[model samples]
Target: MKKRSHISILSAVLVASVALTGCAGGNSSAGGNNASGGSSTPPAQTQPSTSGSSGGTAAPANGGVIKIATQTPLSGNQSSLGDAIKTGAEYALNKRKEEFKALGFDIQLFPQDDQADPKIGVSNAEMLISDPDVYGVVGHLNSGVAIPSSVKYEEGKLVMVSPANTAVKLTEEGKKTVHRICARDDAQGPKAAMYAKNTLGVKTAFIIHDKTAYGQGLGDQVKMQFEKDGVQLLGYEGITQGEKDYSAVLNQVTAKNPDIIFFGGLYPEGGILIKQAREKGYKGYFMGGDGLDSSDMIKIAGPAVEGVVFTSVAGDVTQTEEGKKWADEYKKTTNKPLETYSVYGYDSMNVILNGVLEAIKANGGNKPTREQVLDSVHKTKDFQGQFTKVTFDDKGDNTNADVFIYKYDKEQSNFVGKAQ
Candidate 1:
């Protein structure tokens, strides 16, 4: 990787770097007007990054600077999960900074706030792509954002390792730069349907989606599978995001009086819907996908959030001894609640850093190009991380991807084991 050294270019890089401060260290620097992101992206390396990590003084950088970015919703209603993803990626980078330093490189994190919007995500992708120091990116909780943002990443030859994009269309596009550690909606939706029909013994259902790529796509999958299982489908409808009142949709759903209500959206709306549904006197089972995995739902819906079941690509880390230790340290370090995608974010970044490390080794202990890192990441096999065992298939989907079921009770999203 060649870095620009011209005086003007270096000055511009420094100014833009100052303007674009990604979230790290509980806010060491201020961020911009909107979304989780940095400003203009430059290919050149600047003075030592001010990520505000607690690590010691960074080692000398003889091999230029290498940056790994995280693109997630960091400053919105969904920031609960999105910030965790950023923090997890930051933690992974801090742990391996010394290793990269030993290899004559200084590592830094560039987290972007997608704001759960495709247009903003695409704009952030362009900024990330313009920067030459960035090689690998880990992020994108929403599959809609990931799909379009990935097109930009491919244009720049930047490899993106996503922690929580579950839509099937993401990897089916034949783009070499996009990859995700989580399972797809095709798997997640059907698994959720099976659980609803077989385990919960539900025969009739009503579906409500948030009218986005992730929510609608997952809802369609569940509807298809539910029909196959001979379950009665009372209603399948869409709802707008960012709206407080859902009385119109609630009236339609309550009229159906189905055995279960399935929502294919995030926690903010999921909480409001179920909270209002209960108040509307619709006493039926409630289920959803991973978008409801955040603890914020409990806060949003209060007692109404209990008994909610969701399927997630991430599993409970505290079930293992090492995972428990990591979770404890994470809480103590960041003072943030441990969301499910946090471990996935950590694992995804490690996977990217592993690829960067290999690219360096292959480059004879020097900086490697983004193409080299992309190729290295595509060849990952049986690489274990904090949570999942990852192995990317030819299409960039993880072969070891598995879905886990969770139940919310007593103000916790308790792991109900893997979805079989």
Candidate 2:
């Protein structure tokens, strides 16, 4: 391993010599970052609207189908993460569906693919609102998509519980309908910066963003904190989303020889950047935000991804016995391995469903309106979830929202504990 590290450093020196020459061609290098960012994602809108029941005991008139939607990307680049969130919500609703069934209501999961596109997200939001059956939505992995989609939700008075979307604007817009269980970019970014500055002990940093809402937003925060911490800012750049070659920028990054490279975007771009940068002999440490939470990065970046640390809004669920059991069940239910956001999706869905129950109770065992469900969710206080507890402030942001850091190992990323 030491020999390989030395060889890798030598190779970097050799490559650094020629990096500038090939940068203009833009063919020699790779990578951006997202929540994933189809190249981003969010949880989605699922099944129809309905009031909730308390412990299957509430005799709420008749049990009709209560559709809760998860609005996340199920296709495209970020699908790995998108699907993860969807599956979590799916498991949550499916597990408790019987409760609704006993209450004479069929609780169904309605997952909508925002495709990580803002326009598509808004359209999906409109469609879910029109359905009237979709009471609450669980998605959008991308903050860019989530922001606009949230506008539609606000206009329709539909409650949206996001498992991913971390941009501050998602909640700061004064949109009462928007809520996220995850920490915002402001909280996530600074802690990541602190980790890089204090934990990683980096002195110089290079910042790169995907040029999208979530990516740029997160990048800006990390940048502000890094500068505040007296870390030398090597260069701040933006990469086009969905692009394959990032050699030009990689060359710039390699030339500067910063102690660390920080990416603000999702897994798709992040993976490529790490892989390509490594292949091109950029041996510095790389870090990112929750957008790098997906395990798919291991496949994309291969051995190069080893030791890549990141800050995620989602916490490790396997740490606790109940969470460990839930993870195993998640694998059994989906016939697939669990990803980081799975617990988050599950919790977001449960929050919405819990709100439904409260709404039903508040309405005297009658079917409640979307407004009631919205009000109930907004009033959420100390709601215990499988992974974390939630209490939405007036801004619909989780009050206990925290940022956790993790580093990629041989098989997958492991939790390094909470950053803040």
Candidate 3:
């Protein structure tokens, strides 16, 4: 991929302003003439007397730290997705360490492995909240894991910004501390359904879910949309995840001879289901949601993954110049290419870090409380980043994000094309 640089003068100005204005006390204000029409003197400004300073002379405050935790599956079938998110977030933090330090604090990342299980996710959430320095989170890749874990964060008044969780209820109930950079399943499901009917020209479709909260919820949304579109629904079934043999269910689905098969589950089971479906002589098109996005899907299903399609809440960031530069740098640093949710991870981390910076500025370089950071995040509007312009809605979801459809190319062993 080609790499290019796009400079942001606004970011440079913001950083300079924060560093220069850090030493000013909270009560400092611009002076104005009094009612007597006499000259009013401005308050004396304190500046960091560091060598890096362009002007002013006061030492910046020290001894404060902000720790952000990542709760995601680092081991197991879904490790690819989790690892991608971790890499993206860590990259963002490392890239902005100096800028954050100049604001009188150090940024630290504490990643916990959720193993894509709700129980484990809750345990990880507890561990994260136990640390007083931990004020923000950047994970819980699976909606099933995120839903249960967010309750813990909400109780602690800690903010969590999700990069991949898309269940509607995660944002629907108005959880103040919960926010996501990705579009909801409610948005993605209808888009996928419409593509299946109008774009793929599929007359009948069968829906299957892994029975997890993420899977079942997405499948139900897709089913609802498909029904509303007046397409023939062959069947809607739920299967237990981590089961090796899906031949029994495949046989039942094959009997219907549906024009399309949509699986609402992670790559592990989705790959296995696709492999088994092809093995059973089912030749119809296979479709899925973001859960089927990882390279592991192709590795699991091999040649059987040809012509499969899926919906992702994120577009191909590498298509843009700034995104390409980021992707190239990410590959050089981690020796791994960016995955579907990596940009979401980068954007989510940026949102959190920006909020922290804003909170610190609001407090006149003083260490901000967790509640202050959460409030800053809630008030974000038109915050531009590499992926998109982020503005949180009343429900804490990104108001401007969109969904994209991608198809797997068997010849290249990768997904290509961004269809909106």
On TM-score, the leading prediction is: 1
lDDT accuracy of residue 333 in candidate 3: 72
* Local accuracy of candidate 2 as per-residue lDDT tens digits, 41-74: 3444443322232233333324455778887777
Per-residue alpha-carbon lDDT of candidate 1 for residues 318-392, written as tens digits (9 for 90 to 100): 998888998998777767778888888888988887777556555544567899999989998877787877899
Between the candidate structures 1 and 3, which one is better when assessed by TM-score?
A: 1
The best-first sequence of candidates by TM-score reads 1, 2, 3
lDDT scores of the candidates, listed in order: 0.79, 0.78, 0.74
For candidate 3, the TM-score is 0.86
- In terms of lDDT, which candidate is stronger, 2 or 3? 2
Best by lDDT: 1
Off by over 4 Å in 3: 1-61, 411-420
- The C-alpha local distance difference test score for the whole of candidate 1 amounts to 0.79
TM-score of each: 0.88, 0.86, 0.86
List where candidate 1 sits over 4 angstroms from the true fold: 1-60
Cand. 2 TM to true fold: 0.86
